[model samples]
Target: MKHYYFFLVFLLFTSCQHFEKQVPSEKELLQKELKAINWKEVDEYPSFKDCDKLGNKTQRQQCFFEYLAQLIQEKLSIDTLSILYPELDTIEVKVTIFPNAKMKFEPQFPKDSVAYDTIKIDSILNARLVDFPKVNPAIKRGIPVKTQFILPVIIKVE
Candidate 1:
């Protein structure tokens, strides 16, 4: 009877360990979801024009960041608002935009597993100039007529 009990206890312990190991970590799940994104379906947003006129690299960067951020929020709200987990209440997604390219979301995860689950952007949003000055041979442009950008999307999970 004693040996049988000991064997049963060992089996239970081993089974629990296996179950725990089988649960995918938040990072792994997020990465998998991101990888599954179809980049071709993502919509492109208008690019920042006359960035050189901002006069400060830091300010320009911040402006571009904010612009991209808004775009991400709008797109997510329109396209993915319903599909998100109920725990996620609001998402503050950040995005970087680049000239002649797409907006991107950088990977970020909580160091502590308990903090929160991070969902990286599944797809990249392409950017294009909607309105901007035309480069002329006679005029020297102080403001950057064009620039590459990076965007981050922060999703608010409930």
Candidate 2:
């Protein structure tokens, strides 16, 4: 009877199941991670001079825009431009700052019919950059990146 009990116990133990672990491949893991990231947004906005002192992201961004605008305003002879061409009192300029600190400026005038010295405006904007400190480029996924900003400049006769 004891021998029979021992044989039954051995059979039960042998019948128990075991499973092999399933592991994901490197490609599969990478694809999943890439899809989870926010491609449309940067991890951090570009930093300009004093903007780095701001603690919050929103405030930093605001300070960057303000500082850049102020710098441009100081450098730009808007009054002269307006005086030369009264029609160009307000303009919307799109500025693209590359990771290398290179810039491209595109001005959107009030209307298609307006004509002005665009080259001079562009040159003025470029020259003003000298006063502005070297910028810390935007970051996406820990990599430095470039960004674009649309700034509006309004000149009043007052």
Candidate 3:
């Protein structure tokens, strides 16, 4: 009976030891999760009301970009940018969309290029680019995030 009791106790002790695992700390778990996430790509791109219904990620992104470009082109068409800078064919505009759905547009000019007045273009863009439709911010891990991209807008003179 004594030997049997000792064997049972020994088995219990060994089994408990095998089950004991060192649980990682909260900070360590968070670090591991962050490392696993891809920082370069967003799970969902910033979208408009018309763009949100698209099933594919790439198609949704493309629709959003094209819609934005068309809006910009339409707004700037009435402005005097084309008349002032007829030689300038296209302008690169840096667009930033905030999580709060606010948008900012800034014109990107080449450093060495002095053909057009930068201040005039900046003011025109700031004044013209307003009252845009509601934009849903980008999503990453179910959280809204700010996104920025440069878009080339063509200045067509009729």
TM per candidate = 0.35, 0.72, 0.93
Please report how far candidate 1 places residue 75 from its true position, in Å.
0.8
Give the per-residue Cα lDDT of candidate 1 at 77. 58
Top candidate on lDDT is 3
lDDT: worst 10-residue window of model 3? 112-121
Ranked by lDDT, the better of candidates 1 and 3 is 3
Candidate 1, poorest ten consecutive residues by summed lDDT: 135-144
On the 0 to 100 scale, the lDDT of residue 150 in model 3 is: 98
Model number with the top TM-score:
3
> Mind giving the per-residue lDDT tens digits that candidate 3 earns over 1-158?
99999999999988998898999999999999999999988999999999989999999999999999999999998988999888888999999999999999999999987878899999999999999999999999899999999999987777
Give candidate 3 regions above 4 Å deviation: 1-5
Query: Per-residue lDDT tens digits of candidate 1, residues 1-158?
Result: 99999999999988886666567999999999878865433222233674436766567656655765655555555554335445544433333334434434444434663434343233322222123222211111232222333334655332
Residue 143 deviation, candidate 1, in Å?
Answer: 16
**Among all windows of ten consecutive residues in candidate 2, which has the lowest summed lDDT?**
123-132
TM-score of 1: 0.35
Global lDDT scores for all candidate models: 0.46, 0.74, 0.93
